[model samples]
Target chain A: MSDKLPEKRKIKSAKKMRDIMTTYYLDAMTAKQNNRQVAWITSGGPVEPLVAMDIIPVYPENHGAMIGASKMGEDLCIKAEDMGYSSDLCSYARTDISCSIVKGGPLGGLPEPDMLICCNNICGTVLKWYEIQARYYNVPLFILDTPICHTQYSPEIARYVRTQMDEYIAFLETNTKKKFDYDKMARVGKLAYTAQLLWQKVLNTTAHKPSPMSAFDAFFFLALIVTLRGTQIAVDFYRQLLQEMEQRIQTGISMVPDEKYRLLWDNLPVWYRLKWLSEKFSGHNACLVADTYTSAWCGAIKYTDENNFLDSMAEAYTRIYLNIGVDQMADQVLDMIKFYDADGLVMHSNRSCKPYSFGQMDIMRIVREKTNIPVIMIEADMVDPRSFSQSQIETRIDAFMEIIKQRND
Target chain B: MNNKERGSIYAGIDIGSITAKAALIKDNRLLATHVILTGYDPINAGIKVFEALLKKAKISKKDVPAIVSTGYGRASVSFADKALTEIICHGTGAYFINPEIRGIIDVGGQDSKAILLNAKGQVENFAMNDKCAAGTGRFLEVMAKALEVELNQLGDFGLNADKPLKISSICTVFAESEVISMIAGQQKRENIIAGIHDSAAARVAILANKIKIKKPVMMTGGVAKNKGMVAALEKRLGLTLIVKDFAQENGAIGAAVLASKL
Candidate 1:
């Protein structure tokens, strides 16, 4: 271990990202004062229409990540359970619901919404979650139902989603009391597409030996793309981030101080334990080069056409990483393993995110059969730290690393 | 152990959830092994086991150059040169005992686990019950108390059953209540014990099947001494399991083996 700091590993773009996020949150929080309508949106909801209508798009899921990372998830989750919500419900929904009532989160709580946008592209849980919020806030709710694309995206499904996209715009018009601006939407769509592309390029930089960044870093940098995806700020920030990652690649600076083994992470991160998990892997000289969660922002790149932004988004948003079959999900995981040359797979098996964690066993089996690489499943919640057991997870990680080392040796 | 190399000794102490074990190794050979009740204090159990083993081996603490501690209380051994998890220690110990062994099924005090070993005697993969005591010694102890029988006499009683009752619950608390209800219903004690073993074996088998555990497997840990458990697990897995004489001290022996590297 060297005493000197690793120069390129210190991501300079992180400060700017934080500043941008703080500004975005402040803007959302003070939307009422600014006479700007706020629309609470799901992570997988179409935010471009909100951007086009000048309605501030606030994501509870993103706020849930903040709550989890801040280590306030356990309390918020308990509050929701006390309020009669089942513990089995998604932690994001639980935390967000409780935080709305108690004003308990990193940001005190998300801005109260005048309208709610529910997208089932991610999961069915959001539909109920948003309905609960809409009733509580006395707001109109719009649901964009994107049927699961088990294998392929059919024209009928595409037509159904596209028609809803129009209804989505109409819903925005009704709530915001503003006309639909196609010109601004086209621009926002292009920016969103470019941001996604840059995010992909940033993630792809890990393909280089001794990865310049890790999935931990990706989890942090993912905020802009998730919240303010259609804005020029996100595009600018990602472009800068991409350049820094490329520089780190050229300079041969790795995130893991002594990178020997590279692993791919599946599902959402154990949010509160990010630093501990990062250090644990780093201690073993294993770098989590990629994860399915962070890469999800750009996972459906092939479906988008910047020219046909609105129309193409119908396909792109519908065919996200979580909106597919297990076999297809496994195929994506296999492709990631090959792309990053990962030595093993670490699946979180998150208790909170059912859509992401449900078919993980099948994916693990597929990865093992195809690659013959060791796969470990860690049972935990994305937000709730109560579900995490340090010693149990530590043993699994240590034993997993030993196997990788043995095979490598 | 080579008599000439008795001066160079290594110690491994495993303070598990229910028992503490210590093994002394000299010249790549196990010199002596000791096991005692872990009781309440894991830190004291680690120290007491090491001292007891030293006395049993007729060796001073100064004779051992390195000491490695393992098990749930591995970190409690403040005097050890290093602390390693039970998973690695078990793999190393099982391999040291029989290099031919390709898989390991360890059912400890509070948890059960399955480990797959490669040809090089390294852990290929492993799985354990996540913070559950369904298929562990604790579960058996509770069942023993419920049946008003001695824990050691459980194996013999289970073996004598003509028709084992079915225990459906995967939870120790629920299973114990089920056993109590069975007793009230005038069910035979041996049949209930056999049912308990069957349920435990089912849980352990799930972990083993998940990793696709290889054959030529060996059973380790304190519960391995229970003939009924060994029989039930073998039946569930549909494969023969090799239970060593020093199964209880396997983790401690593996820790000692690991200490040799230090």
Candidate 2:
């Protein structure tokens, strides 16, 4: 098995991605100097309008991921707790809030916001989190309330969210003191749709045996889609990434060296332990072929219309994976398991993200009952390494792999 | 043991938080076992227990071909050929002792868990206590200290309780204070001990029920020696637990068994 280990192949797109992201962050950092406006937006919030208005969109959630990946989450989280923010708040929220005051994250904190975009489509916590940040930063705020779509996207729900979308545009205009640009938004929305499709295609490439890439790679590549979704750069980067994946598939290059077992991940990753978790699974000759978390960028793509981007944006954003009911979440998870030919499911019961982690147990049970494949639930915080227990998770992974091996054999 | 039989010996060492246990197996038979306080250093404890077992079996260290370590301190044993998680070790150990065991409920010094096993003896599913000592032996130790009773006496005293008091605090520190207040309120020692056992058992049972634990469950780990805990867990789970004489050494025994295969 060791002899059959695939040679380490670096994705050529990673270097380019770094350059693009560096440029993006640098632009945000110097936005004030350049007389450009910066709008802090939730990861799931509509960024096309902001892009169309020439307002550079910044994601505190993305910054939180950076803080976590750099292992600076604990200090920022502690700082938030010291400032009377509950430790129970999302680590991303805690880090963002604390990092803003301390200038403590990797990039010495995000640039100040001219306005804030709060979307309740991701979770209810974001509403309060954004409100607190808005108060602190003294920025104009736009709140997009997308009701939970339990079963279907009703017309009433559409009308309610669409009204908010119009209000969102007006709010943007008020802050910018300029007329809204419909043509630019149309182009931006089309670019966002293309990027989402390309991302979905890149992820689908893992459906092949001995997957060309793993969810760890997706977690890294996910930054572009979240931060610059409505930009030509994101679409072009993903197109190159998808091509790279296609080339890997053609060359029989595999992420998991042996790739005897394939597992699907659910929920936000333990950001601090991404490499450890990846290697742990790879050591067992198992590849995390797909994940519900990363696929979320493209999960609602079916609702998106490239041509009618603004009109369809309401449904596409509202019916995202986090905003849907547990049953729908389970259905999507089951579909991924079948689509990826997964042998087991590994669910992270994240302590930070409640909306993503809350329905995991039901999803786990649903997948097990429907597919009879084993599901492993690990309790962890996506950002805060303090919440993770290396020994305990190691044991769970080893035992889970043992079970998978037994059934496969 | 004959020299030829001893040459095939495999050793398993389990360095738990409180105690270090070692088991030696030769020709698929339990040759010798040792248990000792792990103290502040697990590495020394692993070496002491392993060396002690080797002397008791009257064999040289070179006679053993493989050594497997388990438990929380498993990684500290640098001499171990392989280290396995206590979950797999416990399940493997339990199944080796009783082939019919479909589940394992292990309550060690600091942690408690329920492990479900398939017919092939592989671990199917498991649930563990959070990063707390509420459902573990440490919880009982704290209760015993609060009750002013010996740890070993807790089992018999609880068995004599007419009506056990209710312990509602899930946090170990709070539960200790609750027990102290109950003593101040003139609660019977037996009743308080029984209440403590009941609460701990109830917490452990949640783990079992969470995973839909299977039947013929075997109880292992240091806490299993306390008859009161086993009884309380059995009552909560409504299943008779299979407790072997070497229940506390089960993980070590399983480690030794795996070493044999290695």
lDDT of 2 by residue, A1-409 (tens): 3325444556778899999999999999999999999999999998899999999999999999999999999999999999998888999999998998999989998999999999989999988988998999998888999999999999999999999989999999999999999999999999999999999999999999989899999999999999999999999999999999998888888887778999999888888899999999999999999999889898999999999999999999999999999999999988999999999999999999999988788888888789999899888999998899987788778878877876898
Candidate number of the best DockQ: 1
- Chain A TM-scores, per candidate, are 0.98, 0.98
- Compute DockQ for each candidate against the true complex: 0.68, 0.56
After best superposition, candidate 2 residue A346: deviation in angstroms?
Answer: 1.4
Q: Where is model 2 more than 4 Å wrong at Cα?
A: A1-7, B1-7
Tens digits of lDDT, candidate 2, B125-189: 88888777899989998888878799888999998899999999999999999999999999899
Per-candidate Cα RMSD to the true structure, in Å, reads 2.3, 2.4
Looking at model 1, residue B239 earns an lDDT score of: 98
**lDDT of each residue in A165-238, candidate 1, tens digit only:** 99998888877778899999999999999999999999999999989899999999999999998999999999
Judging by lDDT against the true structure, name the best candidate: 1
> Model 2, residue A346: what's the lDDT?
95
